[model samples]
Target: MSGPPPAAVTVHAPLRRRVTVQGVVQGVGFRPYVHALATALDLSGNVTNTPEGVVVEVEGDPAAVARFCDRIAVDAPPLARVDSVHHQEVPATGDSAFTILASRADGPTRALIPPDTATCAACLGELADPRDRRHRHPFVTCTHCGPRFTIVTGLPYDRDQTTMAGFPMCAGCAREYTDPADRRFHAQPVACPDCGPRLALLVRRADEAGQPSPVTDGDPIAAARRLLAGGAVLAVKGLGGYHLACDATDPAAVERLRHRKARGDKPFAVMAASVEDIEPLVRLDPEERALLTATTRPIVLLRRRTDGPTVPGGLRPAEGVAPGSPDFGIMLPYTPVHHLLFGLPGDPEGPRLLVMTSGNLSGEPIVTDDAEALERLAHLADAWLTHDRPIHVPCDDSVVRVCDGRPLLVRRARGYAPLPLPLPLEVRPALAVGGDLKNAFCLGAGRRAWLSAHIGDMDDLATQRAFERAVAQLESITPVRPRLLAADRHPAYRSARWAVRNAAGRPVVRVQHHHAHVAAAMAEHGLDGSVPVLGVAFDGTG
Candidate 1:
């Protein structure tokens, strides 16, 4: 009756496949994630990092292989960004176990590197646990967290290509690096105090042009805290660059830092030791709190608390912090060094909050070069709390605010950079030099677009050079060679001029401000001219 009783279903033979995953997969615990995924599916084969991206081979039941491919994209590591995944079936091999192989140089160069992440909770717990060998280690990092974009020198992110290359892992760390069950199995930045970057505190000499000398035979953290508590301004090196830090509660210190830096009434970003330290100062909603504690650890702009018990110094938000603004930029300690600055819990001597502003003269790039910092910041900083780790590229902290319960990015850099944004429409290999003011360039290939970390005003020579270097770095990772270029139409804009100068005979398209905004929105909404939609835009100048 039904049409010859439906044909019997057929079962397929065991299948094998090679999957190439693109996007921010390297340096992010991705190999271990793939290893775990393959083992769980009872698949056999291996995963490896390649210039193009992560490559995985699996042989198993046809269904299991299919699920492995699907889950790899869906259940990737938190920091892994799966842009485009391609898989093809191949002849099955009789492999018994899955393994993570050493990275290979041969392949397409489309792998994205992850941004530097804040210390993970597990690492923080280990830091606080006295029994852990790495307790209070300033460079404590596992596969789950720590430096990524800031420390990486090249693609196929490995220890050798990173700043950590200089520091060989200790025997204890070596075991964890090779242990598949360990959290730090292949973490590139994995290190202990025995082999890691060292910190030092240098006090500036009275002679303005003289080099600062190290404080004699004292704990650097303790010495730095003492200097800060005494209202001394310090140039503290951070993940990307140096930050001029001082006790936020000290009105005179804040004023001094502001005056010396030549900053005029600009609200400074504050780094609080913990949520408990800032809860009384800012009215944090659930969204704000999550943002404050997120792995990205961006400076979140929050409305100041109108009613609360004053902090130890009773420093009002409007008094010395955010002067006319209703909101204050607040960030929690993201690095172990930052946590150490406040001292261990139950210690009441250190400052609970610090004014963590970028270390630079007005209208200049943030200082990354140690020698440059010494020379440029001599007048502003009373001492320098720095380390031996070299910063490859200078990235400023990203700034964000919550609007209608969602994060609104004001400045995207550091923790949120080197990650691609999805493009609704496919475009040729192209580079878009953003506005000269905010100056965030974009590299596009196929359907993916990578916006670089915020590059400050292009008017400064150092910033322009930083922009070019950032573009080159992004190019190495994105594999998006620009056959076409786009830039703002403002004839006088420096970024536009840069685009023209660097086009290298490639076609350059000039786009108007409003037109570019509309087109971006259209692409984002997936409108391919088949339907019409109303759009509205408001510019700051308007």
Candidate 2:
């Protein structure tokens, strides 16, 4: 009736477009996604990773090309934040297939790196499945989740630029890494038990003159669990830095660690396997639960429960863990190592709750160097559960609390550093060295500002050196080149002194402490200062 399906008419002529997508696109499965998208649309072209961003060329029907451009940013991967997408029409290539090309490092690095994310659901399932090849693998990861900002040393987000460079992928891993259909395609940190980081348990031996020695017998995770159950303190290396962990239910262990670390009644954060495990100790509102389970995996502070279910076998959090505090800071396992430390299914029972705190003296930066951790934590931990992967940046755990059903950031580091905060107005490229107490600096250019991770106090030389390193690293990854420096007006403040020393001929702007606080509040609220507003600033120094 339709003239025998007359000659398969083309609704639109073939067209091509070159597309550029910016923001957190690299190291998060953007290329494979593009391949799948183009294949579905019957388009021909290629996708490539560049320091500037992702570049894609698609030649297909004009309507299909328009759809691709529209959906490129809208249907981006969960971890990939597409800030901008620009495309231009070009001559059609008349090709038949879409392909992913190797990463090119031939442009200025403008792509933003994503923060480290917790293990995704897929990887977790494989970890617990006995039939899976990655079962019980400590460093199991995929494109959807795993280390990002901490492991990355350069742009273009390739494996060779990460700490995993030394551990080449096995044939099995290589297959997954290359297969676009696989979840791990282009995952920079992808690995398996055959070729990846390995864990070792080092215990202090009396015969070895109190020096820690490797326990080559049995699984390191199992050995570490046994030590924890026996009221031992452990120095456990994590994605960011070292954490001093002990059984939270053991009153003796908690007191011992407090005394050793010189923590005087300051509350310690605790890590549990799930929300159910911590419900008896803290009140879990819906918002608090969400924050605890979020991919960021920050320590959520919750109100303490006065009367709750009884936990057997002395499994309750010790009073010494958070004495005189009405809230308890709790977080779930964010890494495979932490999950194994708490024991997986069919594994020997271990401590369900642990008091996890920064592995450092009372007021020093979190220890990242392996040898330094062993030396500095000798008196703090009875055993060392560490790996070979180097931590390029020392990021402490982030802390959050829900106030009025809204989350408030108490300390932003591991999960939320180097991410730009959109400013209400543009400003010249500048650096602001914060006060000496908290010592977090900011780098700003245009309408974005990036706050560095918590850099510790500036009272000691070690922290000063750490500050310099952090500044250098942050500058390398960001586009900000400070043309102006800002510091507090306190003449003798160590932070101010450091800013002046490193101004390098740039003018230093000294602002009053309280005035800076009020201005920051205004800026955070997106106030353009066109209207007068009353503000009250309160702080110990102010």
For this target, which candidate reaches the highest TM-score against the unseen true structure? 2
Q: Model 1: per-residue lDDT, tens digit, 1-542?
A: 45677779887777899999987889888898889888989999999999989999999888999899888989988888787899998888888999889889876777888889899989988887888888878888898888888888887889998888888888988999988789998999998989889988899765465578887686888889999999999999989999999998888998898889878888999998878878877788999999999999999998887887377556443266677778889999889889889887655578888999988876667888888889888888999999888888678899999989989888888798877777777789999998877678899888878888777778888888888888887887778999988998888888888889999999999998877778776875577667776767777431
Over the full model, what C-alpha lDDT does candidate 1 score relative to the true structure? 0.85
TM-score (C-alpha, index-matched) for candidate 2: 0.96
Model 2 lDDT at residue 244:
97
Q: What TM-score, computed on C-alpha atoms, does each candidate reach?
A: 0.90, 0.96
Question: Residues 1-542, candidate 2, lDDT per residue (tens digit)?
Answer: 45665577657878999999999898889999999899888889999988889999999888888899989998989998888999998878788889888889887778888899999999999999999999999999999888999998987889998999999999999999999899998889999999999998988875546567899989999899988999999999998899999999999999999999999999999998778788777788999999999889999999988896345555798889999999999999999999989988998788888999999886788999989998999999899999999999889999999988998888888878768888888889999998888678899999998988888888977788989999998888888889999999999899899999999999999999988888877877798688998989888683
User: After superposition, which runs of candidate 1 have C-alpha atoms over 4 Å from their true positions?
Assistant: 1-15, 40-42, 60-67, 206-209, 312-318, 346-348, 513-542
TM-score of 1: 0.90
Mark the 10 consecutive residues where model 1 has the least summed lDDT.
309-318
Best by lDDT: 2
Q: Model 2: which ten-residue window has the lowest total lDDT?
A: 1-10
Count of steric clashes across candidates, in order: 1, 0
